[model samples]
Target: MKIYKYILIGFLIVTTIFVSNHGGNVSYALFYLAIILPIISVIYTLYVYQHFRIYQMIDHKTIVKGELVPYRFTVSNEYFITYRSIQLKFYDDKSQVVGGDTTVEYTLLPGESIEKKTNLRCNYRGEYEVGIKMVVITDFLRLISITFPIQSKYRVMVLPRVLNLSRLRILPLEKDAKRTLTCNNPEQIEMDNELRNYVYGDSLKRIHWKASAKKQTMQTRKMTQNPRQEMNLYIDLCKLDVTGMDQIIIEDKMIEAELAIVKYCQKMGVPINVFYQQDGPQKRRILNAMDFNKLYQESPKIKFNQKVSVHELLSKNVINMGKCLVLVHKLEDALCIQLQRLKQNRAELVLLYFTSELEEEEKVKIGTLRSIGIYVREILREEELVNIL
Candidate 1:
């Protein structure tokens, strides 16, 4: 664009000087042509800008991290003017566009269209938008280029990748711990249809919304409780110690470990229920065959909140604590005490702490937790996940 502008300016200056110094028909004619050419180019560019259309499409709206998604774009010329030196710019630093140039350059003749497909690899897990940043349209002489703003956009949801942990074995509970887990004599199938105000750990499906509306408060139904102890997975995403990039890495690892455990339990046909913290409040969700999409949608919502600790999150528990599997990014004394209390209540527990580096103090804390009845593991990398979990 700069080169074309400089050439046009130099041509105009030379032509005007020649016509002024040497007054002749040939010089005058050249000056007029030089002036008319740019005018024509500008007019042609404006016309093409009005007639050109851009369309963007994606193969999938949601994909897991590390997966390549196909993105297709179509540029159409609806008018009689031919377009050359055209470029499509859609580069953004947040995402990686592979298999093609960031700015696609091509020519579109009158009443013609061109389509190009490229693969987009999303490294992070979250919601993202993929759209054309800008369209560069140039004239036949390449003297003028007009950039048109694109209003069309598409949304892509990148979910966390579930690791293949086929050979991974969950650490077994002790004989006494297993007995305690099985000895809870709650009826296998008893329906307690009692309506009460909504609590943190209540199932969303059992919400008595009609009563809630009438009473001007959220109400939930207390259903029959299962006697058999299912796996209780607790995810604590509070980030009070780490900051900046370190905090980000911790969050990612936490998600990876949590999802890996969830996927493993699902594959092995283990009855499991997830209790996680969101916005400083405890939330519960029972995993089932139909909850994959819901899980994906909610996983991104797990983020750092206030200065919350795992112990504080667990202290807000409303349901009976059973065989507990705790996933946390950081550990504190309050959390350790809570784990001790949980074990004292005859609950079988396993703790997986995801951290990149372990300090001396942290190692000592891990040792202390293991000294108790709690099965503890430090997950440093994805490869160690199988043996550690």
Candidate 2:
């Protein structure tokens, strides 16, 4: 109710009393006065609350990058029946409007509602909330107005883009696959595996109490194995020096290649020794996306044809794997010589290379590798794997 309703009722009552008490022409005057005042008050009160709504909304609670999110907003009048020129604004964490701004000119019949919807895409990572700072509603004459806060914005967490390797992306093999090898059971060996020693996530049965006391660090239980041939998986992930293409694009390519090889071998039942050339010590297990926390200690330098020393350490493996797969990065002369020597001992060797920028020299070299039975292949692009296989 507006002030006019209250004032109109008060005047009507007072006029009735005065007209009855005076009992004359003034009664007629009172009747006219009561009518005029109430009408005026009704008009003024309706004018005050006419334009009245703002709303912000999102279709879902979560979204991933490169995907679309549907946004919906609604505006309506509570009491004053009037038209509204409405605008919906959406903002991100940085308080910047991102994509969902809209305007509509419509009238709200008494107790009526109107809604609008739009689609939005987010290319960046992190949680974003969509909000409207203010909503304005007005009367048909554009003289009356009201402002209200939208109920609230919805929060959406956008996950990072997934890496998809389409073709010949090369990744180095984990420790060399030797002629005959077995991954020893964990219970038999005795050593700490991950550095930070042990944390809450590790199993209690594997705790190295002695080491924990001595080093004053959590010691994770590690199995002592006759060290198997460890294959260092070196990736040339750096693309900064190369101009023109975006870093994230290159990262995507490399990530795709890495995941494909990991998934492929995992499916094939091969036990790999994995490592990033930028870091020291190799990870012997095939990693999944959730295993990112393990890479915290790893820092690898990206190079065009990065080399790791796992091939050189093959002779020390107590267990043999029967073969070695070096993918993505090129084999150095020393590593090639070692591979050749190992091949004579019944171990198979495969060398894979890829690029949109391979030179003639590299191309010819790949042919020479085939002549030596190194099983070398080059892919022009990720999608070209169809022809290679």
Candidate 3:
């Protein structure tokens, strides 16, 4: 295109010199044509920009992450004039058009429409715009080119991929199951000898009718304090320093790992308490499949832009005897110290650190945590979750 522009400029200069040196009708006509050629090219480009039609469609607006979706787009020329040197640019940051080039070039004749059919795959979990981002139109002369940004964009919501694990390797399923069953039995509720006045929100089953009658007031049985025995799962919601595709990959993998673990716990009849920070501290107790389903449905909306880090949230909570699973994108000294403390307090700690590559410093931190009896797993990719967990 640059070469064509330079040649045209050289021709215009020659035409100007010829008209100045000679007095002939042909010379003047050539000079005028040289000037009018560029004007006509610019006008043709503008005309094409206005008349060019683009239609993009996807089979669904909501799709699972990494799932292939059928997508097709059509470019048409409705006018009598032919459209030349048309190009397309797609949004390749978070989503991709499978088996298709990123930039597609085409030429359309009068009333001609070209349609491309392919599959679209979203690489992450979130709501983002996809498909044709911009259109580049060039004139036949290649001297004038116009890039028009597509006003209306195609958007889709991508849900996180949930993996079904045959069994949890990090956790002793049989032993944990037996302990969980023993702890959750209603018959194991030990009542204190002391009774207290029945509160308005107290359960009716806990009311001691005989004690209430003797005291001429409603009394409730005081239950013995049970230690924190349920599995605690923490998701790191703090935004990483990385941006663009790197951030997307880390956040998506963390969410997928959390969801997969939740599903596995539900399948194995293990109750889990998931903790994260959204607006503030958020916790979800998953004891059944329905609870896991609700969490799965809301996974796409979960953002990692929280001001609170997972370590801070853990510090605020009481960590006692139970399994603690922490999923974090980055490892910090403060977080490692907190994990060491949890381990010292007899809390079984499993750290799922998500990273593409481990640096020397990170490797040392991971080793230190593991040395202190914290089960640390560095997840390099989403596919490794099945074997690692």
Candidate 4:
């Protein structure tokens, strides 16, 4: 096409010279038509793009890291001009298209619509963008091409996969001498009890309407006592420079180990308390096996580069002096210091340390954690997840 266009243009130039020299009307008319053809082609290309519509759809909004997510791209031409060369280009650093083709080409006539389907996969855990990033349109003569950027955005959460482990064990601390009263049912608590500031995990039904009306703030009925010792799941979401694929694997392993422990605790009918962070103060949630989906849905919302650390979370006096599982992606000196403090409080600590490749220094640190009577286990492989928890 380029060769033909150049030949015609050259002929038009020669014809113009011939008409200027010999004054022939035929040559003058040919030159004028040649000049107008390219102008029309450019105008047509621009018009086709202006009227094109694009829409995107995805099959699943939440998917595991290793699973394939299906997406559909719909492009339609609403103008009278036919698009000879149309391409839809989309790309994201966080995800990869399954077939390795980020651009899809098509030929569309007037009022024609086309739909292209593809699959996407992401290795890391977080919310990833998936939509039309740009579009490329060109004329049939290959004279020029135009690219239009589309801001249409869609987000899909990539959740970490968990290992289904069997034969897991959790050694709890010695039972306390005092037990909770038999009338300690949560639902049976009187609504007219003491009022306190509303917390995230508090049930809305326990809201104190009278106090809220007087104080101009939401308040929840405070429970007198929480007798059952709850199991704690502490996940470390501190920011890390994850530049290598190995580091990503370590992150996934850390999440997997956490899930395995949660599953085991839920199976044993234990009341669990979850603690983690994302760019703010650490958040806490108390749940049981029946609320497992809540944990699954909330894990992917952790944004990268958050400042919360495992040491800051564990050092706080929030956790009860009972059994706790600490899932960490990295082992730091400060974290070890906090782990030692749990021993003085008589809190049973189990550490699942995830690493891609361990160094001698890390091994020695793990030994130090173990020396403090904290059960420490290294999770380097996917298979180790079965027993590490």
lDDT of 1 by residue, 132-200 (tens): 777788888888778877766666777887776754445464564334333324235444668888889
Clashing pairs in 4: none
Best to worst by TM-score, what's the order?
A: 3, 4, 1, 2
Among all windows of 10 consecutive residues in model 4, the one with the lowest summed lDDT is: 177-186
- Model 3, 1-389: lDDT tens digits are 99988988998999999989995999899889889989999899889988889999999998998899999999999999999999888888888988667455799999999998999999889899999899888899899788889988998989999988765676645455455543333234567878999989988988999989999999998988544356889999998877766678888888988998888777766678999999988999988879998999899999888988888978876556378899998898989988888788888788889887779999999989888888888888544566776
For residues 1-389, could you state the per-residue lDDT of candidate 4 as single tens digits? 56867887798889788888887778878888878878987897878777888888888888788788787778887778677777767665667665645455688888999877878777678776765677788788777677888756777888887666554544533354122112224323345577889999988888888889999999999775443556777888775545566666666676766676666556544566777776566545545555766777776775435577877888885356477788877788888888888788888788877666678999999998778788887777454555644
Candidate 2 regions exceeding 4 Å error are 1-233, 238-241, 246-250, 279-284, 287-321, 329-346, 382-389
- Residue 322 local lDDT, model 2: 53
Residue 39 of model 2 has an lDDT of: 54
Q: lDDT of each model, Cα atoms only?
A: 0.72, 0.51, 0.85, 0.71
Best by TM-score: 3
lDDT of 2 by residue, 1-389 (tens): 24545665787888888877786887878777877754554464356344455555767666555576676667767664454455444454332434445454456666777776666565544455545655555433343345545555566665444443332223223353322222233122445465455667777888877878999887776555553333334344322334433333344344444544554443333345454444443544753333432331121113333344545455444244354555554445655666666666655566656555678777776776666667766654434343343
Model 4 deviation from the true structure expressed as Cα RMSD, one decimal place: 12.8
Which structure is stronger by lDDT: 2 or 4?
Answer: 4
- Score candidate 2 by TM-score against the native: 0.39
Q: How many residue pairs clash (N, CA or C atoms closer than 3 angstroms) in each of the candidate models, in the order given?
A: 0, 25, 0, 0
In Å, residue 53's CA in model 4 sits off its true spot by: 2.2
Error of 2 at 95 (Å): 20
Better of 3 and 4 by TM-score: 3
For model 4, state the Cα shift of residue 227 in Å. 8.6
